[model samples]
Target chain A: MSRPLVLVVDDDILLVAMARSHLSAAGYSVADAQLGAEALDRLDERTPDAILLDIDLPDACGIDLLQRFKRRPELESVPVLMLTGKDDRESIVRAFEAGAIDYIRKPYIHYEMLARVGSQLRIGALMHELSERNGAMTRELDVAARVQRSFLPRVAEVAGATVAQRYRPTTALGGDMCGHFIAADGRLALFVLDIAGHGSGAAIVAVAASGVLQRAINERGLDAATLRGELSAFVDIERTGFYATLVVCMLDTRSGELQLLNWGHPPPLLLERGRTRWLSASGSPLGVGIGPACELQTLALGEGDRLLLYSDGVCDVARDGFELRAQALELALRDEPTPAAVAEAALAAAASETIEDDDMSLLVLQREAV
Target chain B: MATQVIGIEQGRLDTSSGDTLERRVADALAAGASEVAVSCGTLALVDSSGLGSLVRSLKRCRAQGVSFKLLDVTKPLLRLLEMTRLASAFEMEHSSRSGAKTSV
Candidate 1:
């Protein structure tokens, strides 16, 4: 194992030199900093396992420096030994109160100083271990977040319709999911699901739902209602007790026919000719008993028509007893030609508010007027 | 803060409330309350964290054969639940009877 690194901070070169010799002989990697400023700079370069801080410095007091070190969460765990000449009970108490792990008096015995430093090094090793473990856990969540992103399609485009999406999870991994799929029959399938909760539990349910949707739409050629029923049954409320609100749709450009199925989700928007209309969900959300068969409503889409699908995280927040209504949602859709531009414009409107409590995802589909 | 009795006269139940609300719900389930009624009628707003806590609480209640209900949900609170598609997840004391869109 490599020797633990120790930083010795003192204005007196003689004392610094003495610490260097004692620390080096004790099998420690020593770095001497003659000024408080220099010591802080060394910390920035690499965190030492323990610090030997002088009580008196040209630029700052060692107690003040100790406060600064404690303020930094990353440096808080590192043991700091106060090097003082006063040896007074008042100063010693103050040093401990200021967060000094131990103290060494001026003109101290070499062996005594070595013992204090060694004790600190052992505690420092445990501190470093805890920090590393926390860091590893955070990295695992990051990796899982990226893996979740992979399950959703990046983009789906075809000759008649173009789909664009933007997804944001409240936590590193969230319950919100969205995807667009172009079927072999020239029908485009798009969906956005919001699980009741967030974090790993919600994320697991989202992944399973999205995975099934991808497979059913791509291979089975199922309709929106049938797909909804199957997915609802798949999530066992009696067992997992996890449910989701979702909007799933399939658009066929060949006959300008559109099929939509919604369960306790925000209504999708249809914008054309500077006008916007809401698409109806009108059914209880899934995992709530998969009640009466879902009704699939058919609508027509021609050139210049744009459809918007989103999760409720966009309008769940109420202002003055009113949340984003159809009129407000209509304004968000405005009129953008391409799916990318439309989603961009709409998301900008949603981002205007500061407080958001839910994860958000948006998917826009536009039929090429040309 | 005590967790056994979670009765808020009027306030916002949010992350700032910490795990207090969650603990109360857990205690209710542990005590075998046939149905735990969370009174949101006095609550002005609840953020996503609050909603998430409720979801977890409901799951716990279900595992123990208990019902989780939102008591006297206000118009704004009901709208929020509906928008999130959670209107059907938890039972509501006052339903379409009060012209409030909620699960019976």
Candidate 2:
């Protein structure tokens, strides 16, 4: 491999010659420029591994050139060692602010200068490696986000109910997910789940959880208790140390029966006849310490009744007088008519004064009495 | 909403009613303010203790009849708040001179 190139830019010809001699002796290729303008011209012709710059150049100040170098994509990664006459703290700080990698006072000792240059070169190499890895990770996350989006159910009307849903990922890939499946016997199975963490790892666990839930639903046909047990088993087998809160419910249109299996998820809000009540089931969240069989809760749906299923991000609103999950749901459903309106209002009530750490997902289902 | 602006300079609040900054903020709330807006534009850097001070200020504001807001937060300070989720707790403005935006 060729020795690393070091470009020396200084108006002092003697100092430039001395630097070139020492650097060349120390296994480096040295290039020379008499002024800042000449250095810029040389930079256009060929890039150097590092720059040895003098603060008092004739054409321009070293700080200005450092700023210009930082703006150039190709040169930004090149380390710069600033040379000045004084060893004042202000000048050293100013050099750093201008993006210089290191600073040396004039009349420099050969060994110290060489050591500093070597250290900066090592930092530059490590930074380059890190940048390449970051680029690859970003591309992977983009693909993951696209796949997560596809997993969500599209906007559609259910035969016996109106459905409205919303999902917002906290990161490029999120742990929150919502899915709906309609059985041939006219039972609508809908669920909203929040995985423990955020980002790509959590997203992978969420996708896996969804797959497990879908397979169970496809085979068993919305049998609420069976589905819950299968999901719990899947979580136990995976052993990913990741937990999820889920609210799985099947709505039977013919009988107006709503059977729910809640696994440590926020309780659903049941709105009927201008009154609201919490619909909760006693089951542990999946992936916690394994326990007894998961139990299912059943409730009879009344005419013009709406059921709201959401992640904890909605129920955990921090505003005053909104601490209880029931209170937040009440504020959202107080003046909403349709299922869509209720979903929108709930999201608005959950909106914090700033960005939320976790993703928010909502599913609203309203039964139309025959 | 009522607005009350509190300014901090040299990393210290002018009100010295208590030893800790949080206690001073609580004292300020007790002195009759409904909506508290803290200005930290001049602050260079704040440690975790300073952040705790700010959180205490927010909690005090909430306990009182006042709402909590922040103004003139530098970028580094904003990053600290974001890391701790304190940014989500208060209404934050870019600068004291600029009007507070309705949303973040």
lDDT of each: 0.73, 0.71
Cα-based TM-score, every candidate: 0.73, 0.68
Tell me the lDDT of model 2 at A199. Answer: 73
lDDT of 1 by residue, A1-370 (tens): 8888999999999988888988898899999898888888999998888898888889998888899989988788889998888555677788799899999988788999999989888877777799899899899999999999998875444767777888888788989899887766668888888776678888988998888877777766656555665687455544565667778878887676788878767788898666788775666667655334456788888877888898866655433323444455566566455677767766666666543556889988777743
What candidate 1 gets wrong by more than 4 Å, as runs, is: A5-48, A57-80, A87-123, A154-156, A219-225, A232-234, A290-293, A317-328, A355-357, B1-36, B46-69, B84-104
Best candidate per lDDT, number?
A: 1
- Writing each residue's lDDT as its tens digit, candidate 2 over A112-137 gives 99999989988988998999999999
| Top-DockQ candidate index | 1
Give a tens-digit lDDT track for model 2, residues B1-104: 33556666665322231125555456556666566667776655453235445655665576565777777776656654443334545688765353222210
Instruction: In angstroms, give how far residue A353 of model 1 lies from its true place.
Output: 1.3
Residue-by-residue lDDT tens digits, candidate 1, B24-51: 7776766656666666667677655565
* TM (chain A) per model: 0.75, 0.84
- Docking category of candidate 2: incorrect
* Candidate 2 deviant stretches above 4 angstroms: A1-3, A24-29, A87-89, A198-202, A222-224, A237-242, A287-295, A300-304, A317-328, A336-341, A353-355, A368-370, B1-104
